[model samples]
Target: MIKRIYPQIQGEIESGEDVLEEYSRDWSIFKINPSAVAFPKNSSDICTLVNWASLENKNGHRVSLTGRSAGTDMTGGPLNESLIVSFSRYTNKIISIGDKEATVQPGCYFRDFDKATLRKNLIYPAYPASRDLCALGGIVNNNSAGEKTLKYGKADKWVKSLRVVLSDGNEYEFRGFSGKDLEAVMARGDLFGRVHREIFRICTENKELLEKAKPKTTKNSAGYALWDVWDGRTLNLSKLIIGAQGTLGLVTEATLGLIIPPKHSRLAVIFMSDMKEIAKVVDICMKFKPESLESYDDSTLKVAMRYAPEMLSVIGAKNIVKLAYDFMPEIWRVIRHGMPKIVLLCEVAGEDEEEIKSDLDRLKANLSGEGFEVRLAATEEEAKKYWAIRRHSFALLTRHAGERKTAPFIDDVAVPYENLYQYLPALEETLKPYRKFFVYTVAGHVGDGNFHIIPLANLSDPKVRALIPRICEEVYRLTVEHGGTITAEHNDGLIRTPFLNIQYLPEVINLFEEVKRLFDPLSIFNPGKKVHGDIAYAMSHIK
Candidate 1:
């Protein structure tokens, strides 16, 4: 049926050229064409096709599928070819809206949804940096978070219910206790007994780790829904599927919690010559528990400058203007007698302007006590202008890297805040031995103990390309030694699968596999992803 109807769908399926490119490839370093693509019209369409695929797979023939939205993922969340499925067309409805809950098609964009909710003076605030482009499905899949995560938390936090299509062609609504609404189901003796049995079995087996699982930050989207368990209240099954990466089931739709938007916001810039100062400032700023505490090192600042120079200027900074010459010339760029090596571009929002000002003063005093300079954005507009510079600088600085620079991929690793000073220098030492390459920036969400790195190196030489991973491997190993994870924001997709085992122990890694097999026994739904043993298989299927 798909083969017959698909030919005609090429035109109707994609009303605009945007679909072709938008649905094409994920951020992974692979690409391929799916056998068929879908822009589901509703839950019915998503369910029917998924049920068909599940049945086909159970009969010893598994059809591969990949679900994606907006193509904004850098961790290979989208694909060009396969039985690619999308939610772009089914975004027209808001299933139900109550005082604190909203059931929506998972494809809705945050900006659109937030604007509508604002009319009613309500908000759905699991925002990500890419919220402007990210979809609800993508947010849940990645367990995404943003600067505001300090308060609202991640995608998983907002989920109240999930509409899922299980692997065996079954669709079920497994979710949080709906007050008295679900009292009937909870009272169903046999079904309730079985559901609780499976959940208890999985939880019991994972109890040890669950105790130790303390999320890296208040937010994370690592593997599955391991963080869904909580006592004292009734069980909420939807939480388990909230961050499952499309493994156990395909989320056709979801019902989530919402909030009220903040009335006021303040943006500020704190400059430091060292990463340590940023950490110190974080400890103090965290006390205010303001909306966000964001930091970026010079490497990231370079990019943000191009993208958000107004941000840098707000703090009285111009481009460091990196020289293409050699190590000696590059040294001049940071010499203070060097440009500032690191800066924190932060946004704090609240209801009281006086409180915001007081918080800014406290922040400045702490930063100044360390003998650093501080820049504050007087209003939201000015703050955004500066942020624009910071955001764009990540890309802007590279354009003139003079064929000597390559787009730096972020190594989303994190260690305890106190350990970063030690960890960072050790990482630099390993790089120094490979003299030809340049180091990128080291900026992060210090308040949460997670940082992103752009290890910009000139990998044009074959020798340099081979050496790249070797250097990264050393850094990854060091991070593990410090009891940190190799990935913080991005999951270990095909790109990082080869190193996953080294980072995770045999037993821990094995459990990840067990979970995968249970969810996708045939291994056709996103094969060669998020597991250890499939490293070799993943290398073969790039896109």
Candidate 2:
């Protein structure tokens, strides 16, 4: 039957007795063994497989096609027991690079692309946290963004074109910017623009519904890109693909925009007396405009210092002038003045070291009058050492909490800068209600008004299900109240489905349903996910 479906393909089809653990689950979250797995060796093979799957609906089997980008999605997207299209071997062809845009297959890794584009000194900035393990397709699926996004936006912004395979077995490439301009020149609407024109007209017709759908903040990876539906009624194709989380269609390939590599970056650590002082520092740092501005709280720093002593050197402030006290020792005065209960790791990128130093000097002078130790990371090695605290924070935090057998939830709850003051106390109060449970760390791209809370709570006990969301609601409501996103970068997977309504309006969710229906009308492309439904049956059982 597999051969009949994909006659042109020359690859193994794991079925029945031959199906193994590899087909059972993805990297994390829910797990489900597919009825069969198709390992396609080429794009032609994929075309045939989807075409066959399209025909299989006649036999009453739902045609749900999903791409496996190194099988690394945390969303249980890869585990589905449907027509699992594995693109492990179809990685070939550079296609071409035109005016800083390059198109490649779904299986390509960003690091590999970095190497491929070295001569041009071009870098793809939307690097995700799992870039080392994730493929281009999965990153595209999640619309992945990471630490670098503070300067360079999410992956969606950089995408020039997308070669997506729809459920009907018809191949449609959603090309952005350039294609639309070309279409305007030719007097025929391009694929993406044409689709956008229709959607915009539909949106204007349904203006009442669209009004309710507008999000609380500028950046959101919640469900569909409902807010980005129109750019002055022009329609943005990139928004549609960014956070759909693969429920929309299968992304086979993408052409991404590139940027020039920065000449130098100066990283510094300015200690704060308390978490309350962080928001003020973050607001100030935003004025300087660094390559990256991040923070690692007491939990992360202490954990890293235990495992890696090199982390002590992350501070890169040029001056530590003691303003008030002439009697106290320099170390004591500096330490006592701004003894960061929360640490701010800020960086400034420029043409050379002198530019970095000059900016740091001015920043220090401006802030030193306010009383801060102002530690700086001078060299690349020093920068790496300081960065170890953040890079290894998850692992170190896990190791420190020995035998608890914990997992990193990696929740992102954010708000406007004004409400930063409201968070610290409320978080303290929320965690207070949960006995024996502890908060790990709270730090993130605060310059952009996004923060991550790594609350270390044991998941096994039933109390967590109730307690976590209560705390989550506290944080999310605060986020909504302050005009922020419930999710910053991480797309809504099985984990965040329940809290969707708290952050979105009734019509926004209805729009999500409309998009889901548009993409997977059969509701078989990783069903019961990115939509609120039977969580226990979908997530807990299949694993």
Candidate 3:
């Protein structure tokens, strides 16, 4: 049937075992061989594919499709037996670039998009650290936020509009709904209109419930962001779809809102021997109103030093290194200052260089009072030296872990900023039982209380896999207690999907299910993903 439908679209469709295997898994260890993969060239091709998928099969089951770009998602969002509509190859293109917005196909790489925007002095600030490899479509689906997220916000905030394709083959550019748009939608009285109207009613009716259900953390990327759809005044479908992880609908293209780049940025890398001091340091850093504050625990630094020695020369910060050495005898201290238990990277930005410098100086003075030795970046190049450690910390773990891979199952948790001081130790205590086998290393956007808990384990071993459920229960219990989200930055894909019920109220989960049904009633769009599926299903197909 797929072979027959291949000729209907301009895009290429391959169903051979070799081709299917290529589309199977993403960056995640989870793997599920797709039945077929399609490289769609345009929206027409996607529309045709989606419409065909909506058709009933011999057993009365409609074929399903999963939208994919880059296939670099850590979660198993793109892995399925259904047809995979991959956008990373032929469909990658910037449709149009405007003064404050850029319309791009789902396949365009984030780094490529950023470079194109930079030519016009415009910037897309929500790109993840893996921007070089991640695609813009993936960012929108995951609603990713990077180092500058504190100032510019997540991918959803930057998305002005979305060109989405519904399961029934209807394509629409969703930005927001107005009186006329709502009236027009209701006038049609079709499935799309009904879904739209139902969504509006659901959002408006559950506004308070939705608000109360939100995690107290500064940022979250879990389940459906129902709270964002209705902002008390406007009804925006794009906001709801932004972080739905392609389960609700397939995004063919996205029109992203851009911002002016910061004129100057000054960075400070502070080191503290005690893990407990991290909370105090973060509290002080927050008072300065810096753009981003990141932290790296001792375990992460131990692996980082293997790569850090060569970074100074690679970034070309020779002059700054000499000046920093003169400023303090401790400059000769190793990159991690003999592997301090905790390392904090704080960055402040503005239009004036002197102002940024003054802010950095004040931050340094404040941190110094708390017994922190600060390594102020004399130039942007010098700052990259510090940023390099944080940026490539995950890579270092991957490199060092010979056979055992760093499983991010419990990574990207964000507690309320104030709760972070207490949350860290409790989390460590939670993992103590499995400490012998599971390696725990913490690093991430500490400024927002979001940290990546890298728990390394050889999943090939049944012993390690057995402890996963218990470990997860303990960790999530602590996360819930602290008013934090079980999944932060990384959307609740397959790994976290089954855990949604535990994180959110039953009523909230019902809303997520309703949203899924309204957009994908036939369940032809990434089924068994966010709203539906069990933990056993999530735990299947390990790479």
Candidate 4:
């Protein structure tokens, strides 16, 4: 079948074990060998392939397609038994850079986009943990957010427009609709027009319910971000597609919103004894409106210490103090002497240095009564060190887990910011029964009340594997009880799809299905993900 369609596409298409093996699994525990892999060089190439896949073959089966970026998705979004459209290999290119926006191919790396925007004195703000490795396509698809979520917001906030291709080969550039554009959309009789009309109707009809269901947390990337489309005025169709995880359609090109780079920035690390004090510090840091606030538990820091030197060497020591610490063994004694059980890392930034210092001063004054030790990163390198602890903590856990691997099943749960004190303790107690089998560590973007539980379980053991559903159930129950989201920034792929109904109302889930059908009638694009799948399907394939 691929050979039949090969003449139409202007890119590479291959099958067999060697090609199939590359697209089999991603960073997640799930693994499934795809039937074939297609490397489409451009949007036209994608359109042809999508149209071919949508047609019924001799076997009366339409080939399914899944757009892949980086293949570093931890939720099994890129794991499926279908034709993998490997976007990152050839489609990675920054098309254009404007004053406050940049149009880029979906395959462009987040770091590369950041570098390109930084050169123009602008920035694309959402920085997930996989900032360097994750591509723009995956980030947008997942609506991923990182430490800066509290301030800069998620991928949805930065997406200005999208050039998308539907499963039936129809191409459309989605952007915010003006009154005139909305009228024009409603008047058209074409497929794109019909899509717009249905979306507009859904957005308008369910405006109140959508707004009410919006999570109070700082970020969310769960089932279709339908609520973000209608803002009381014009409809922003791009927001709906931003976090659909490629189940909606193939996002070939994206014009991203950018912000002016901050002229000055300062990061501070605060140490507290327990969750209560850590929560208090977070409150104070939030009041200061830091760019991002991250938290690391004692277990996280201690684990990070095991890999600190190696990470420091990679980050590079620019000053004598850092150089001495790198070369001198005695420096560890002083550093380890006052390490606290919990740490909160915060960053404040603006164009003015004095204003940032004043904010830092105010933050310190507010935190004085908490008995917390505040350490301002004196140099940029020191700041990077503080941030690295939060950035690379997950990797450290995975590296140190020797025989076991870090399972991300219940890792990105988030609750209301005020309920962190209640959620963390309850979550810890919930996992107590399986503690003997799994070694889990907690770290997260604390300002937004989101945290990750890096559970190091030997997945090969049947007993350990059986406990996954129970662990997920307890954690999700606690999250819902606290008015939190099952997934804060990571979109619901195979991991959280079954639980999506638990998060939203039945009507909303129905609407999600309708939306999926409206865009992808054949369900060939990344099937068995998000809105319509069960956890058993995902759990069964855990490898």
Candidate 5:
């Protein structure tokens, strides 16, 4: 049927068992086998496929296009039961790089992009922890963030423009515009103009409601983000599309702004015995304006230690002896401190080495004055050891947990920094009842108050599987009550979409639906995501 309807397609369309099986699962807990997977060679092929899907839907055949890149999404955002449109196969490219920005295809690997930017002493700083495995499309779709987000903000802030193939089967460029530029766009009288005009109207009419619906957390990737579209003067559609998770349209190309990284950097490690002073610790750290503030619980540290041998593959260790030598100080510290309940890594970066070292010295003195075990990394190589644990803890659990697998349902919750003292304990209390079913680890961007709690569960056990919905309900309720968002970086895919209403009022949800219909009237894009996500359907598809 695909060959007949879109015979001009310049890429492969596979429905074979192996291909379908490969596209069935992502990093999330769900498993959904799409009918077929289409790899478009270029933007023209994507437009053709969109037009074909639209025609099929009009002919009483139900089909939709779900855009996917590296398939590194942890919320089932790239999974669909209809047709999967993967870009990594053919559409991957780094088109051009300038002094301040670069244009790239959706499927461009972040690791590759990072290397290119490093040559120019520039970086797209909103990359997630999965930088080695993720693609630009997933990063943009999820509005991704990482350690540097404390200073540089999320993907939405760096995205300068996007070329999206809308439900009308036409590609249009979207960017921020005001004054005569905005009027020129709305005056075109085409689908693009009509879209801008209608969206501007919707935003202007419901400005107060949209403002009220904004999440209080430092970062959010849950809903439509309609509140960020119009700020009275400039209307930026890219903000709405950045975190829409491909529900609005297929992003064929994107131009992202970049920043020059600091010339010198150092790390300050803080070992906390308990959560009693977490809020104070964060407050004190914020005063110094660290480039990155990250934390992980004792469970993650233990996992890293138990899988110590695996560190050689990730941390660039020369040999086991060298690895042990590099780890000797930390090992002795653990022996003396008996393992801290939480480990915080504060990175200070600047143009001058002495200034950064001075800053770290002052930070260490202040933290040590508070009676905390603080260690200042003497070199950049030493800092990598702490980062290895923070970044690869989830990978270690997923690979070496034997019968258990990574279940990231309640991951990516973020609250205000001031509430961490109470919110962290409440979150742990909520998860304590499920300790019998699974063991979990906590890690996140401490500066942004975002945490990723990944549970290792044996899904084969009925009791373990049954705990998913219950845990999601309880934890999400607690998150909302604490004035937080269900997701801070990972968007509302199949896992968190059903729980969006808990964080937003019904009226705002209605506006989200209205925006959905505005861009994807035919609902040919990724559905059941951002809106209309049925909990039953989501739970039934768990692997």
Candidate 6:
């Protein structure tokens, strides 16, 4: 019975069946199976497995608890059935490093915390292009961002405090305070001062309806960032548990906050062949404020040149005739300008290397005086093959989709960059009747008018799993009519938590179910993520 009531849980508590089928799949397309996984080895073995799953849910039993790490959650938010608690074997660690901050341990590894913040040159710039296979508890529960988050932004703006564990199993810590240290943390009466006096009285009586329910895009990890916790001068419940995917609890340490990049960088690479000139080349690459714009299409460069030597282990390419002689100038620009339906990439940094090559020669002469073509990665190994095809084109369509898979349901949508010239052509005419049932890929972080599409399908074809909620209700109703954000960095797990009221409202999803009953009042964490998700139990747990 859970190792005789958590006999000081040192770790490993399996329930076999190949550890519940490897904790029942993650990079989402749900599979669920958990029923005992536990591997904690710290935070007092996660407060004795959340006090033995809150005393096996006060005896009635269907107990819960999810927390996982490096399961690279694409939004199954560390899938759960009951009790999973992984934290990368022995709570990974790094636990300290300063001069701007570090702290670590949510099963560490964002490529080992970006090689320990680049040996003190400092970083942790909101990593995520599955930064060499995620962790740091899925980049602080998926508040993750990528391609240098178009100038450092997500992972809850570089965290800076957490620790967590709640649902009364204890372990507090959080951060951010203000005037009179937020009234001595809401007059410490306990349970972390009634969860900081009822999340500071539900964010000061819904401060202007949570600042008009934020998310005008440019990054959001679906719901319960309770409008970034009381902004009228600091209250920060670690900004609502940094993207609450762990469902308001089980964090187990993290501090973050770091920077110090730019010593000079570069990379240009455009190549459009027109998709209505991607909002006029993202409005002239936002007047050269680039620090990563990124893109990918042409069906992810024809599935990374039909798995060109399995992308020689992600753009390091030492073989396959030096990766087909470095993609022979993109196979002679697809036999002289023919296949480029999109391939941006921008980048641009500085501390002055001749003003980063005169801002990439005036951003390739204002994208060739608007006639467009551009191409400037003169090295950094020609910018690692456009970041190895924008970070391995969704792991090369989940390993050569011969019998399809990678269906990240409308994967991370995001809008508002002046409504991508009328929302990317009404989202490619609302997925043109599901492109005859599958085949997709578009990629993202184009300076934050995010995208990610994915698709691939075949979910053992139950009519292509009944067109995943009618293509997530026509691409989240055209991404909330272009104001966008139905996840800009993968978070409303189990498939966009039953479509968060198609991008919130209804009094901000009833104050996100009263901030999940004021911090899990017995819902026992990570249950159908971000408030009661269902869509027929997430489409009968699609796989």
Best by lDDT: 5
RMSD of 2: 5.9
TM-score of each: 0.82, 0.84, 0.94, 0.94, 0.98, 0.35
Candidate 1 weakest ten by summed lDDT: 320-329
- Winner on TM-score between 4 and 5 is 5
What lDDT tens digits, residue by residue, belong to model 2 across residues 1-543? Answer: 443454345765666544546766664434566666667766666667666665666668565656676776644656565666666656544666555878878777666777777667777888765555667777777777777777888887888778776656555766543355634633544433345555555566777666665655435677777556565534556568766676766676788888877888887677776777767777677778876777767665556645553223323323212211211332364466533466677888878878788888777766677776576665565566556566556545645665343333336666666667776666666657664774567667666666666766555556664455466567677667777777777666666666678777876777678767666566645565567544445435323
C-alpha lDDT (0 to 100) for residue 218 of candidate 2: 38
RMSD of each: 5.7, 5.9, 2.8, 2.4, 1.3, 21.0
Q: For candidate 6, list the clashing residue pairs, or say none.
A: none
Better of 5 and 6 by lDDT: 5
lDDT of 4 by residue, 288-395 (tens): 889989888877777766666755655554553554364233135337755466788889998899999888877877787666677777777667876766777776
Which regions of candidate 5 fall more than 4 Å away from where they truly are? 1-7
Tens digits of lDDT, candidate 3, 330-350: 334654356577788888888
Model 1: residue 83 alpha-carbon error in angstroms: 1.1
Of candidate 3, the 10-residue stretch with the lowest lDDT total is 323-332
Instruction: Name the runs in model 4 displaced over 4 angstroms.
Output: 1-7, 57-59, 316-339
Q: Give the lowest summed-lDDT range of ten residues in model 4.
A: 325-334
Q: Write the per-residue lDDT of candidate 5 for residues 1-543, one digit (tens) a residue.
A: 654554368898888999899899999999998988999999899999899998889998889999999999999999999989999998889999999999999999999999999899899988999999999999999999999999999999999999999988899999999999999999986778987998999998998888888999999999988889998899999999999999999999999999898888899989999977899999888988999999999899888877776865686766656665777776787899788899999998889999888888888898889888898887666788789899888888888888899899999999998999899988888888889887889899999999999999998888887889889989999998898999999989999999999999999889889889988888999999999989999989998
Which pairs of residues collide in model 3? 29-543
Computed on alpha carbons, the lDDT of every model, listed in order, comes to 0.61, 0.64, 0.81, 0.81, 0.90, 0.83
User: Which stretch of 10 consecutive residues in model 6 shows the poorest summed lDDT?
Assistant: 1-10
Give the total clashing residue pairs for model 6.
0
List, residue by residue over 292-330, the lDDT tens digit for candidate 6: 888988989888887877775666666657655777888
Distance from true location, Cα of 494 in model 2, Å:
0.8
| TM-score of candidate 5 relative to the true fold | 0.98
